[model samples]
Target: MDVSIILILLLAGTLVTLFSGKAAGKVALAFGLLALGASVALLTKFNAHQNIGCLGVWMENPQIYFALNGDGLSLAMVLLTTSLLPIIMYSTFGSEVKNPSSFYALILFMGFAMVGTFLAADGFLYYIFWELALIPIYFIALNWGNGDAKERQKAVVKFFIYTFAGSLFMLASFAYLYTKAGNFLIGNLSALSLSADEQFWIFLGFFAAYAIKIPLIPFHTWQAAVYQKAPTAGTMLLSGIMLKMGLYSVLRWQLPIAPYAAKTFMTIFIVFGIAGTIYGSIVALRQKDLKKLLAYSSLAHVGLIAAGAYTLTVDGLRGAVLQMISHGFVIVGLFFAAEVIFRRYQTREISEMGGIRVQAPKFTSMFMILVLASVALPSTFNFVGEFTVLYGLSSINIWFPILGGLTIILGAYYMLKMFQNVMLGEANPKPFADITFQEGLTMGVIIAVLFFFGLYPKPIVDMITPSIEQILSYTHKL
Candidate 1:
């Protein structure tokens, strides 16, 4: 029941899929399900109060360990990562991917890295997994992406350089922390006593990485292009799961290690997040490209999620976690719908797509749920997350929720506008095919999860509350 088993399954899936030739996609899906199953089994045991973590020294001098733990917080993320990988893989079933082996391998390997990033309890080891997750995505986007080659290359390169560069700051921060704490374990680093100035620089160092990875406001320049360029799976991985790495790191590493600075700097970062929310929603309204619209939509969602986390309140942290899980599913479904439309029409342009509903009733049904969920309509999982987040913001100030709530209003306008343009009206007569069983299955799974969680969020809410409280304890020290 060790949490490392999830990483092992993903790595094995990668190796097996790499040699699987034409069957690589199927192999990836099978392995992905296994990892998902593993995470679920571990979850049951976890609630039963069993140890599902492992530790061993990986390096002597720097004192790093092959430490992996599944606190409820980490497991929540691991569940998100594991659950999405199969759907992401299966979403590509209808595409004619060149070099399926390498492509599927990269997908599995990226999952391996992300699972490791979530579970790694040692700081140095976590960085290793974090950076490793970047490599596969870079190649996935650069090689397998849509659009003009030169343009896609530029976007992917910018993403690579931006993320890798930001990570260096995190690495530097970790190095400094190691010097003071003498070990890179989470407990040790979070326990360090540092001067306010030390905490400030350290906080900024981590913030530099997280803000870019989260792509909050000014640092978000790289996201739209990359999302538009990447293949659907790559896009899903980026928006659904990878985006959470930075948000999770804020909870796991950044704040606890630099509590005083987190408290001191909270106001400014919260403003940054809320601004991104407003900016992204407005931009989404303007997007002509479906993927770009969804990209900006995701930017809006994560912006609010980031703002909630920075609030450092129980409501804030809880809402952020819930939103992260729901957003992971919703974004993947939105991108998959985009990819489905593109497969039929050979274009990402919203203007070029219409009347899909007249043709594909199943697709229209599922996609409509996704659209409403994105707008946080009641009884959708997203509604719960968004309401919780807004409640957190309102707890802080009438103004926080007032500004952040604009995401919902603006989000609904843009999302429904895009949906009406793309899915409604006259059937384009270009012969739109209904989604295949495989595609329908993926969308159905996502919609089901959203509805189920929307109705019953208590399980996850309970799971993460203890961990969130622990984090607040650290932040409250200021």
Candidate 2:
């Protein structure tokens, strides 16, 4: 099957999940597996030099196409999305969602939009997929979110407005690109020539959207709130896969399409990225809520990843991809850890958790491994990305790496402290039960991916290098 099959399967999943009655969760799970299976097959075909892609004209007047191609870079992201869907679904197996049909459908629909965002090769079509992704999550967080109904609505709306407004800038940017090139295909737009002023404004417009989406520092106001209120699955999708949409766009859309603008303002954006790293780490140290703390921690990591990307070196870009994939799993694992705790303790506040490690050795072990990975412990997959990114930054400026590297120390400080508080402090009066088998399995899959990739990053590194180099050739105007 072609890459379009992935989109088709997910879209089909959404519809089937919606009308499947009480078996929606199972239907969603089956479709998630089918999507995952489809992506794996594509990856196999991709490695064997088969063109696992589909292209068709969606509109003749505006020069748009329903294009989906699987280069190493795009395929890696597709794998991330497909791999996480089933995991996210499984992560919630122990909990009962009210209106399960709608809940599961929203998740599948969100997956559909996100996968499209990754696979879309046409600029306007990409923007459409990008915007389509926001709808399901808005409903997910608004309707199924925790906390007071009014408060959930408020947070979800804030998130939607901030993201929606940011996307307008992107839309405007694409409109300009269309005028210049008269086509929205990635190849045409990436090769389109424009004046410095034009590239600058276009770059800024894309940056506004990407920054808000990746949520680098000042643009990050909506993140923690929505994370805190959304259900765990929504949080997983947002942090794990949705945010990568921005980082991926940086290499795919921002850098290549406006090479001169990217080269000129690289430092400014790098500074923004590094600043977010430090700022997010600092803020995370103060969050009383577990999910909110993980949210900020995610901000810190993505900031570093973004900073690495703007370095514009092969190492920087490749490291960003590696980090993005690793971060996707690590962040999901961390948030799910929070979910596991919440399920057992009935509270997300750090103060309300303690001494669970004594009762739940299996869960504690997996959570601890995830914590270490977040801090970029040696030999973990995270270390590979973090070290590569820091190396890339160092090639530019010693202080760039120094500043960006702060996420490591700061992350360890806050994460370990949070872990200690949640799992290792004095025993609480309430009895704590160990994780169920399904929950253990969920965390186990995540931990296994982190370590396996950590030890053998060469496969991923080799796979994505050509695509990253092709992108850099554009940025370097070679």
Candidate 3:
């Protein structure tokens, strides 16, 4: 089957589902499953060693190319995209969203753009999809948000402008590189020789874009508000999958292409990452809103991932990738749990919730497991990822890991405190309900994945190692 056909099928399905009305949920699910299967087939047929250019043309001076190419890295991201969509669609079934057709359409379209971002070999083409992915999400947040109209609009707009500003700098960086390389293909740009001065400026542009997206401290202001304001499904998608795009790009574009600059300025990057981790944890400890707290905690976790990635070791890269996957699952479960609590209490404030576990043992149990995972407790996926990252950081500097390790303490403090306030405190006078079948199933799947991969993470580590090797090889050549 043609890859283009797969893309078309997804695009067409989203369009068709927009007109499906109430049945849109079912239609979207069917299309998502089909897309997932087709993606798997495409993976099997993909030639990892060869470049698959789609179409190209000559510009005024430089040549322009539009293409889809897959190597280990792009394929891994594509797999992540396809694997998550069906689950997200399934999770949405439990949601009480209005205008289901438009909601599903936006989600499917977002999936299409995410896959395109991973597959596009040309820098300009990739940028187009990078920006395109944000559009559906903006609408998703605006249309489906839970907060008051003004607050939701403000959050969505803030997210949009912050990310867009960073993207523009990224575009400028790529244009500069294109002038020197005379080609827009990532491989060609990676091969081009660049001076340290040039690499420094280019790296800045790339870092600005990625930092805001992954949203390491300072730049993370937009996230908690947006997460709190957006609907549950939108929050899941944003935290669970969309944030990975930034981290993935850091690996795909920044490291390999500007190795010397990265190496020279490594300390600054590591410092920023560590600062974000500590700062995020400290702030999360104070948040009253459950979703906002989880959002800040996620910021802290991904900051550690970023620090590990910059360590430039095999273990560091592998751990970062694994953590990306693990965090995605853990955060989805966390946000889903938050949704359940909100449905019962009609509020996300922890102080307003209590005795929830009395009537909702199953819900409480699942929430506890997810919280443990988020806090990096032993025998969970978070533990495996966090341990590996620390080990990776240890090789760079004992102090780096030592300072970064503070997150574990802070993470536990806030997480357990939130749990104690919401679950262990005296029962509130208001009535509470037990967990629903759908909610239980969603959390069960996430918890099972957490433990399964935590106990045995070698498979994903091995799969990702080859791509890390390929990326690191470019750095060595530099």
Candidate 4:
């Protein structure tokens, strides 16, 4: 079966959804399931040894080849994207969306772009899909967001402009590489050599783009506002899946293609990652809003993943990939829990709620599990990633891992504080309800996966190790 069919199905689903009102959810769900199944089949058929293929030539330049290829790395991301879409769609059931068709249509369209981002082999094609993924969510957030209309619009615009500015630098970096390699294919570019100075500038351009997308410290001002204001489903997609694109691109494009510069500037880059970790955690500690706190915490977690990738060890790379997956689940569960609380109380302020656990034991229990996972508790998926990442960093610099380890304490402090304020303190004057069956089921699945993978992470480790090995081999050659 042609992989292009996946894109076609998504486009078709979007169109069908826009016209069909009540049937929109069913259509979107069916398409999402089919896409997931197809992605699994593709993964099953994938050959780890084969990493490149051309679907056709898109332009006169041989560089602009239309291609779809996957090795272990791409397969992992593809599987992750496909698997999560169905769950995200399911979570949107009976949401407050009035234009359900358009809402579902945008989701289907976004899925197409995300799948393409993971699969596209040419630099130019990849950029197109990369930018394409942002549009649907921009509209989704602007249209469906909570809060004053002016504030939501401002937040969405800020998010769009910041990310787009970063993307421009990314395009410039790709163009610079294309000038030398005369090809846009990622594989060919990885084989090309550049002087240290040239490599440094190119790396900076790539880093600028990725850092903003990852929203590392100083680049992160727009994120918390957007997350706090955006609709819950939109926020889920943004934090859960969209953020991974930045970390993944660092592995795919920056580290492999510019090893000399990466080696030269590794410390500086790692410093930024560490800064983001500490800054995000400290700011989160001060936030009174639950969603904003989770937003800041997400920033801190991704910083660790970004730092792990910059370490350039197999363990670092593998941990970064695994953590990306783990963080996705943890953030989704966290925000969903926030949504449950907000729906019951019509508020996100931490101080307004108290003694929630006393009234809602099931919700509190689920929330506690997610908080533990976020804090990288023993036997959680987050712990596996964090441990490997720190171990990998220890090989680079003794002090680096020591500072990075501080996140464990900071993470626990902020997460537990938020949990206690919402769940453990004295009961609120206004009553709140317990979790709904749908909400419980959604969170339960996420926590179960977190526990399963946390305790037995060997399978993911095995799947990602080969790809990390391949990346490391490329760096060694350079």
The per-residue C-alpha lDDT of model 1 at residue 276 equals 95
Model 2 TM-score (2 dp): 0.98
List model 1 lDDT by residue over 1-478, tens digit each.
6898899899999999999999999999999999999999989888624336999999899689999988889999999999999999988988899999999999999999999999998999999999999999999999999889999999999999999999999999999999998989998999899999999999999998999998898999999999998999999999999999999999988889899988888889899999999999999888999999999999999999999998989998899999999999999999999888888999988888889998999899899999999999899899998899889988778899999999999998999999899999997889999999988898999999999999999999988888888889987776
Question: Candidate 2, residues 1-478: lDDT per residue as tens digits?
Answer: 7888888999999998999888999999999999999988877767623435788989999788988878899889999999999999988888988999999999999999998998888988899899999999999998888999998998899999999999999999999888888889898988888889999999999999999999887999999989999999999999999999999999988999888998898899899999999999999999999999999999999999999999999999989999999999999999998888888789988988888888888888888999999999988999999999999999889999999999999999999999899899777788878888898899899999999999999889978998898889986663
Better of 2 and 4 by TM-score: 2
For residue 372, model 1's alpha carbon misses the true position, in angstroms, by: 0.1
List runs of model 3 lying over 4 Å from the truth. 1-6, 42-62
**Candidate 1 structure, TM-score to reference:** 0.98
> Could you estimate the TM-score for every candidate?
0.98, 0.98, 0.95, 0.96
Q: lDDT of all the models against the reference?
A: 0.92, 0.91, 0.86, 0.86
Please, what are the lDDT tens digits per residue for candidate 3 over residues 371-478? 999999989999998899999999988999999999999999999999999987777888878777877887898899899998998767655777788888877876
**Ranking of models by TM-score:** 1, 2, 4, 3
Best by lDDT: 1
lDDT of 3 at 472: 85
Of the two candidates 2 and 3, the one with more favorable TM-score, higher being better, is: 2
Q: Count the backbone clashes (under 3 Å) in each candidate.
A: 0, 0, 0, 0
Candidate 2: worst-modelled 10 consecutive residues by lDDT: 43-52
Please list the residue runs of candidate 2 whose C-alpha ends up more than 4 Å from where it truly belongs after superposition: 47-51
